[model samples]
Target: MSGFSSWSRRRRRAVIGGGVAIAVITGIGTYVASNDDLRPLKVDFVLGGGDDPTEYGKQLKIQGQFGGLAVAPDNTTYLFVEANDETVMWRRKPSGAIKRIQVAGMNASRATQAAVAPDGSIYLAAEDLWRVSPAGEATRVIERRGCGKANPLVATSISDFCGATVTGVTVDKAGTVYVGDQLIQTPPYGSYVHRLDGKSIELVAGRPAKDGESVRPSNPAVRKGYDPPAGTKAKDVVVPDVTRSGALAATKDGVYWNTGPGIVRINRDGTLSPFVARRSPGKISDPSGPFDTVGRALDAPVRSGTGGEPGDGLAAIPSRDEIYYSDEGTSHRPVLEGDFRWQGVESDAQKKLLDESKTGSLVHRVTDGKLAPVIAGVQAIATSKDSLYVAVTTDIKYRNTPENSATAVLRVQLPEKN
Candidate 1:
């Protein structure tokens, strides 16, 4: 009787344990179904040293420096271009070995941007736009005539500064390539975005200004009222503070470039309209104060000394109707000792953008009325279907300086079904 009773108790315990396991699993599944955070999608794929250098995806490691990055349609292969370096292409296999794709006589100083077509053809900007090969041949898509002397950065080599300085590029499923020209030299800065589709080139905004005939901003200096930190240099170039703004992404309706402080929609009909005007933190306007003070604030490494918050890069989550961008944190912030500054860095803008956020480099998702940060410290970013890759440029060494340390690329995986 004792033995039978003991066996019965063991059986009962097993049944209870099995029931608990089922309940736990069902609860977990329900949680995952409803919670984005709980789902495995909220994670980042950090690929670097020790992580299979090649297994993550096809990586192309360019020599001189990684200027721009683009992913192929199948989402398995990647193309990385190093601007201004003769060793232009670095291709990484699915295994771990990286191979070099050579482009003969392709010379570009500050070859700052790159993009991939739906057909897998690559386009990169140096002084001009070059059509690159998946297998390794490079040809000119557009060439600069007189603008070659100006050393233009071709966002759209189509007409060469027909709009402004091309600083950004994107493509759609139909192979339509959109280039964003930083028209800082001309007002209503960012008045136009250029589009390149096959043999045609067109502007996507207000009237196209005459080449080199736009309003330019004056140089910045330390204001009598505002004193910069010790050793801060005064700015000499007073050019407009329009940064390389906008990123290209496709939507069900059509292709779009998110530009300006607010996200503006560029329609196929050539109409430019406000898509999300008053969204989060609102568009950080050009800071107003003594121009001298602004200049003093701008006196940073990158901006040198200027009082403007130029918009940088942009990206979007199609189904979410949400767009993300890198806003120059220098909008309203005061000058700090450690912040990165160009010739015309704006002090106030930095303070404004960094008030709540810890890392000025931030990621924001567009909600109903405002833009917010999703991640910060993003220097350069690219997306492969379900993954977002961000390049965080950490340590630096000047010309001829020993490479003490280098920046790293962070991979964030977008939500995917289990």
Candidate 2:
């Protein structure tokens, strides 16, 4: 069922959100960074399969490539979801130990971004929206069909029930989760922005659609209120008037996400602004510093077509003028008729087939409308406090070399003026 080719779930309906769970992680190991000369330091963010060359070499056959990542709000830890291990999520602590997090009710789908609330509550945008409890319990705040399924015996949960497709999710200091819903599958090909503020989930942006309704942005408004329909709701309500594909990250300033072609910010006042946009295709434009670029005439920054054409993964830092994100290349074609369809796809033969494919991801910093490469071969990026981290995939081990690729962590210090 894996590697046959495609982004799992696109899921959380990725292509946006990543794996999420509820709870606080324990037994996290800590490592202090060396500030000997204030130059910069790269350290192991987490320790896991990256050590076992054979492990990743084997996994690459089935896993394909790396998935989404997010840093916790505590400025202490971060989380990442692997392609092969779709259901299980890994949390990297300061101690460098990679701990396993079981996201309750999550489907074996591809994941997107993970947002950490100020209170340490983890909001992961995968499939639907999942809020991980401090006790490590995952509760589906919003449910989407194919994103997750609840056990029939687990009497307290809803199943296959979100009314829209979630692409990105970001939470504010107040713990409000704003979802970028792309009515992807539904007609109208519409997009929207939704908010789960306090008492209920409301449609902060985009026209609301009832189940089975097909309409576009130009159509007259049917309903203007944001209310969740009762009884098995994991389906499309309606698409938004925004970009259909994107990811979200939040800062005290506001929530920002990939608005189709460029990066846009949504202020606390519900205004749409542009942040980092491309001047020419794969280049960043100017004039629009980190301030509210909404309504400003900006250029479009298209995702690179080098690797798998991975869109930008965003992380909102405390700084208003800058942000950290992942810029990956969706550069390869997958092998369809291989043993990947088999159960144990890590055999030497399978590994050989996997090695034939080449792809990479990177983490970059965008500030004052400038681009700087922080880490290359980065699968996902997340930032908190004075630290920035990336998941550099080592899937190349299967290709054969004296030093095989080891999945490792890369870090960059703040004041990223580069």
Candidate 3:
């Protein structure tokens, strides 16, 4: 391999310590005590269903396979969107019951993410963008054709929702919508944090600051870190996947997101920085940026013995700055007889390996600069003031017959006394 490629590969492996194997640790007590409420909130999962069981049930349902998660500013409930093929929005009441809202041809194109403005206007992303109101009315905010993009997966087309799939969205107090585009397989292999001004989109960072002041790289903390591969400079590192867009939530100070590599927060003035910088580094499932160093935060693989897949899916409750994300294994092969799960391998290891390779999910939690595992075998996740929600998919086959697979939406809470 060339120097650059070798560097890139080494950097990727170095991000995770000790190769891909993970030693399991379970205890939310230490991590939860540092945050607000001083107690673990309640968690529950409500299942989604379709009129046709054979078509939607037993398999992944569009409504069931949730993509983006956002909490309403008022704190009454949470909102989420389906993946690319599904454009419907589902509202989860505090009771853990989900109601599907039909926007009626609301941006018929594919949707990768969604967010809500302070006023409760739902911003849904497809190849095109639409704004849905609490009253159920929908209107187009932007379209792909007019945005100067030829495809939905390019970097230059970030503004059009045509390139670098829309992975996460947020709205500021001023009503400016911040959209995170994870563009890989394209130039600038990093995420473009865009600001929606009226009907147009503009790059917020890697450019000028407010008041026409030219933004320069001056922060030693930001500049002194690891560098990308040769010729593949940091300026050109496009985020590898949606995992970089983990739960784009805005605070009075700035915006926060979870990438497969680590958690990052962009300041109100557009200074990009790390939120949680240390975790075992490796090629996490759908990781967003270049992996060059070890001890960086990484999404736990759905299973063990798996490496180099990208990670995606993140959600967080902003009021408390509590965040959650999942790292899915790129491989999907099931564990057969005599596999490690059958050996003396521990169940947690077997489960992580299977969840990454066959069926399962890995969940990570971060707050006040501390990180720890909260759950596994989750594919998608969201958060609210009162709870943490996760979607986990597992595979199943029985005696030469293909049994129906199961996808679960699990809710978890901290023990109140903690």
Candidate 4:
């Protein structure tokens, strides 16, 4: 009887245990199904060092100073890298070899921006827009042109300051390319967004101003671009400020970029509008236009004596519907070296933009109807299948100083199913 009773108790206990296990699993599944944070992406690895590097994505090793990172349609990450005293196209293969991809008929100098096409190719913006296929085929599109000395542009007194064109490049999912351009001379040719479709190129938005014709800005300094003080020249008075396009990213949803203290979105229909304007902690009247708050405050100007302009960084992860950006922390915040005077108009604008400044190098996201903080001090960002990469750059370097030798790529892993 005793043996039988003991066996009966053990069998009953096993049945209860199995029932509890099933109930617990069901509860956990229900929780995960409702909680997005439960499936968060973890930090994977930081790729930096010699030619042979760490593999974060299958068989892929990141090498060199990665300036622009583009994730191809096949989920392969390609970096427009600056190294070995020149710029080169670096792509990681499925078999884990890091190789330099030579695009025929194209040079890598001045390749500061890159974008990926829907068909697994890449475009680099330099002297011209160069397209390279996944199989190493190359073609040059949109021949870069600078307004000549006879273009009627008034030059600046800043020694050797001359005309410039083609600031950056971005491509939409439909294979349409957009080039950002501005006339750096007087008469202040306004910023432009030009469209390139196959064999055709034309202006889709932004009108480049003619002599004595520039868009008058609500900001006094910008208005001053059109009308300089009694004695100062326009080119000398109208310095590069926060109002120009910094970086760009595109999606089927729309094209997004940072102009000065604001985020500008261009729709497929070619409508250009400010999505969010950067706000400084000073001056109370809601910081202009239908704008959203950039959390770093007028953070850039408050930290005076800082190098670089504000809003110089931007990136996007289309699959996640998220765009990450940074404020170079100052708007039109100019740093003068050797024998420079503080002009009245410029100082007034800086004072207004920087008043009550809250300071920090911030990283923020634009998604849904919000521009919120994701990280701090991450001045630049890029994204691929299951990872996000961010880097911080200081404006301490002078012109063309590639000898800095810092080539670190920090990767953050996420629970990305794709």
Q: Which candidate is the best by lDDT?
A: 2
Candidate 1 overall Cα lDDT vs. reference? Answer: 0.39
lDDT tens digits, residue span 296-328, model 1: 111211211133223344555454455545544
Candidate 3 lDDT over residue span 1-418, tens digit each = 1111223444332222111111111222322322222112222333332223234222223223343344554433434443344445556544444555665556333234556676888776543456788665778665444233344332333344553445456676678887665555443344556667775666653211224322222432222111221222222223333333333666666766544344566665544555554333453333222111212243222222244223244556555666655544322222212111111122352333334323334455555544444443344455554455544443334532111333334345442222
> Candidate 1, which ten residues in sequence have the lowest lDDT sum?
18-27
Residue 323, model 1: lDDT of 55
lDDT of 4 by residue, 378-413 (tens): 324565532356442223244534424333333433
lDDT (C-alpha) at residue 238 in model 1: 16
lDDT of 3: 0.42
**Model 4 lDDT-worst window of ten:** 18-27
TM-score of each: 0.57, 0.59, 0.56, 0.59
Q: lDDT of each model, Cα atoms only? A: 0.39, 0.45, 0.42, 0.43
Per-residue lDDT value at 41 in model 3? 20
* Candidate structures ordered by lDDT, highest first: 2, 4, 3, 1
Across 1-418, the per-residue lDDT of candidate 2 in tens digits comes to: 1332344432111111111101112342333332222212222223232224234221321222344456665545544444433454555555544455655655444446667777766766665667776445667777654333432111222332344566677777676677766555543345566666554565554444556664542332311111212221212223243332457777776767565445566556665555655444423222111111222223334354432422346775564355756544333222223211112222454334333433444344556654543333345567665456655444555554312333333344333232
Residue 294, candidate 1: Cα error in Å is 28
Off by over 4 Å in 4: 1-42, 46-64, 93-98, 102-110, 135-139, 148-164, 185-188, 209-216, 219-246, 279-312, 330-361, 376-379, 384-387, 391-406, 413-418
- In model 4, the Cα lDDT at residue 187 comes to 31
C-alpha RMSD of each candidate structure in angstroms: 17.5, 12.4, 11.1, 18.2
